[model samples]
Target: MPNGQGGYQPIFILSEGTRRQRGHEAQESNIQAAKTIGEAVRSTLGPRGMDKMLVDSLGDVIITNDGATIMDEMDIEHPAAKMIAEVAKTQEDEVGDGTTTAVVLAAKLLEEAGELLDQSIHPTVIASGYGMAAAKAQEFLNDMAVSISIDDEEQLKQVAKTAMTGKKVEANVPVLAGLAVKAVKQVAEETEEGYEVDLDNISIEKQVGEGVDNTFMVTGIILDKERVHPGMPKSVENAKIALINAAMEVKETESDSEIRVSSPEELQKFLDQEENEFREMVAKIKEIGANVVICQKGIDDMAQHFLSKEGIFAIRRAKKSDMKKLARATGGKIITDIEDMTIDDLGKAGLVEERKISGENMIFVEECENPKAVSVLVRGGTEHIVEEAKRSFEDAVSVVAKSIESGKIVAGGGATEVELSMKISDYADSIGGKEALAVRAFANAVESIARSLAENAGLDTIDTIVELRAKHEEDGAVYGLDAHDGEVKDMMSEGVVEPLLVKTQAVSSGSEAAVMVLRIDDVIASKGNEVGEGGGPEGMPGGMY
Candidate 1:
């Protein structure tokens, strides 16, 4: 037939029909591809799970059970598999651990759901049942939370140690845990009401050169070395200080605006007035016992020379944060502008020192009473190790903050939620209608979490889920699957619930994002703006901080 565009179109030619069938087959191939990738690392679950050795295309090898790290190292091509990867990112971004668990659970759930679909149990029914189960599971999770006292350091240590298990460096767990606790305590002690410590905030950054000793605080970032100026003094002790947010120079006067000839008479007159003003400023600073100046703005050459001659240790271009730290240390007030400086504004300069030892950098600030002045000095043996350590520290900080703020952790990366979805789907089967899709969607959402965890742990996502489901079906073989010794089976079985906090937000958002990607049946080359037209993916939205 002739189409609207005046091009003759094929009207069901057998040969073309066969070619279309092949295209459909290619699309269907993604299903198996996705499932196969998920099935590759199933057995590595639980505390006793084996480690995965990921050999990249470039031949670099990574050995670990951390979910996000493993998935990040893999070269995944399938859209569905990428969806699985997003889940791990969610878990990592939220709970800092349990990503492996989430991925394994999702893969297993999807496998079982697929089987149920084949058995004539529609996707709708299975999904419904999953929703019911998820609700119940949340209840169980809430019941399982061990109410912890903020002052209970032992319990805090337990929490930190639990997060550290199955990480890249097991030997460093104690060190990381201690650092976590110290950071939490430091932050908590500072707030008026002792704010909850989120473990994610306290990150460890390891830099190598000359290692830093544990006792030092620098209010200023160190350059390769101290500033060099002939008039500038090397050191000043017990020096009075003034901190200004503005440039320490006179503003343009009306006389300066008028252009004049290059006459020595006028030039000397300008110089004399400027010199007097400069001397007066210096005299004022000296009267306050101020031998040092810290400015948030740039220093003028004239003022720099005047301060330098007075043996003032002046530092320019200081950050507001550093200024605050310096003020806290020295019991000084930060003047917003030089014009705002009053006679009483002068104070002793904070003692800020830097020391390098054994390839670590440390900053020292003296006479600071605020708890915020205290910062942990984390040491790492290698560059990679230091980076990882720093990441771990940051995770620890956020977790600590959430724990202190909310007084609980969110069911360990939405594991409870997945378990609940299984139950919810089961219940939904008893009812019927559009709600069935909701049930399926929720189940799919939960399964996504499991798959992400498995991928992160470097296990076959499908196999890991299968193993988890098998363990779940077996009752108590897997630690988290079923409770034992008079305890409730899974957190789901115990009436525990996900915390209504950042953890849940990240998991749900990430899972939704992953599911949106998974739902894609075809791949098309589209413009960037058209990529996420339909509300985009879950975690892929505006939620990423």
Candidate 2:
């Protein structure tokens, strides 16, 4: 250590063997980690991108290239890398698609900032400039956004199809996309702010056995359970459904109690009383005119028998979330107490039935007058295929819902990114300062998505960018790469569409992440208290420092 007085004392701020990185060293380390994470998911960007097969310690495997899923499943140890993952998560949560674009764009922003840092530009300046560029890019996005409505079924289907394009569900994109649109339209409600959707109102259930073509949306709800007893009718028409949060079993004392019975008659009395309570519960349900019961808690064996003898179809131990959806779908009230039940609390459905598929029984409640909540059942030939199809369908549904709610959309297939790049680059010239360099860097980083799309499609990257730029210059800003043919074409006319929220959210999330990483000029990790090796704190980039 050195001081102006030509003398200094060694600082002992951290514990023994603590790992520390400072100044350029720390910034580079963090930036490199961000880049590493970005590149990890880069190849999964477009229709032709590749999928990853991730296996865990227990030998369970996941195969997909969805950016948010990949980042979640990865065993990331770097604190900075986790920050990068948050970018993907935010994109997924906010807009449901374009996670790879957000992540790689964030990484490229950091990589560009690293160059500025080398040339003596302040990190805050770079962050501020990037922020300004991002805001302007959003303006360009909104100005170019096309209005969409719930009735715009064709465009909505295109949005869903674009989302499912590269996820190994291409063969069934048209069918699954229709299901996504229908599901979203069913759950979407018009609000003063726009159409507001509660995706919880839509449930997705996946079963392994049938081909993906069998995937379909249910008019009502699906419970992944069966009848409590086989003696009960397997199907009930004109079903009066009761959604119960309370258990049908006899209530046990909450505390310990002692009962001393000197004779067998006394014990028999206790048993009769318990049996009568079960009979009373079943009788109460019947009195309320509920032919079908869905319980959130366990039903005792005695109670199940009574329910079956009464010709009532009942399911026990249903999930609380499922009960909520059922209430929404059937227009029933979730009764917390059996004693408080009444006919008014019962909901009506055309039919309630139990069906077996893939060697398991499931209950379906359908044909409600107008269900507020709906369900989609995804089926495939195998577990892995079904799981992946479920993911693809979910992404499609999410984007369509967002589009319906926001009432705004943009051309997909990298068209928006290329236009955004050109707009931001021109805006950088007007700022005219050291910050201008950072702004230009922002332009380049935003273009990484288009580049990745081209590269993944096996097109020449240099030629692709050159032609895209020329097209934008020629006032054909909506023209983008058609990955299927390696040609520049109009994305909007080609039926490639995405929700505007996806692009703006990606820009905002990616820039914020890049700024957070850029401003971190130091990293201090405490040492691990091990007997032998140099294992640092829980999140020390796996000892990379």
User: What ranges in model 2 sit over 4 Å off?
Assistant: 1-11, 529-545
User: What are the per-residue Cα lDDT tens digits for candidate 2 across 104-204?
Assistant: 99999998998999999999999999989988988999998999999999999999999999998789999999999998888888778888889889999
Error of 2 at 446 (Å): 0.8
lDDT tens digits, residues 1-545, model 1?
A: 88989999977534321211122232233334445444544444333345677777688666655667766776665445666666777777766655655555444444545454455554445555554544544554455454555676655665665555444545666666666766667646435764645332232335543222231223222322233245766555555668777766766775647757589998998888887777777666767677667777776678778878877767777767667655644557888755456657755533544346464434343433443433445555655555455555555555555566657653443354445456556655766765465456555656565555445445565655665665555543212322112222344334322233433444344334333433444444233322221122222321111
Where is model 1 more than 4 Å wrong at Cα?
1-136, 189-205, 209-243, 248-261, 264-292, 300-302, 319-334, 342-350, 357-363, 409-507, 518-523, 527-545
**Candidate 1: worst 10 consecutive residues by lDDT?**
536-545
User: Number of the top candidate by TM-score?
Assistant: 2
- Could you give me the TM-score of model 2 versus the true structure? 0.95
lDDT of 1 at 307: 77
Whose lDDT is greatest here? Answer: 2
Q: What lDDT does candidate 1 reach at residue 281? A: 70
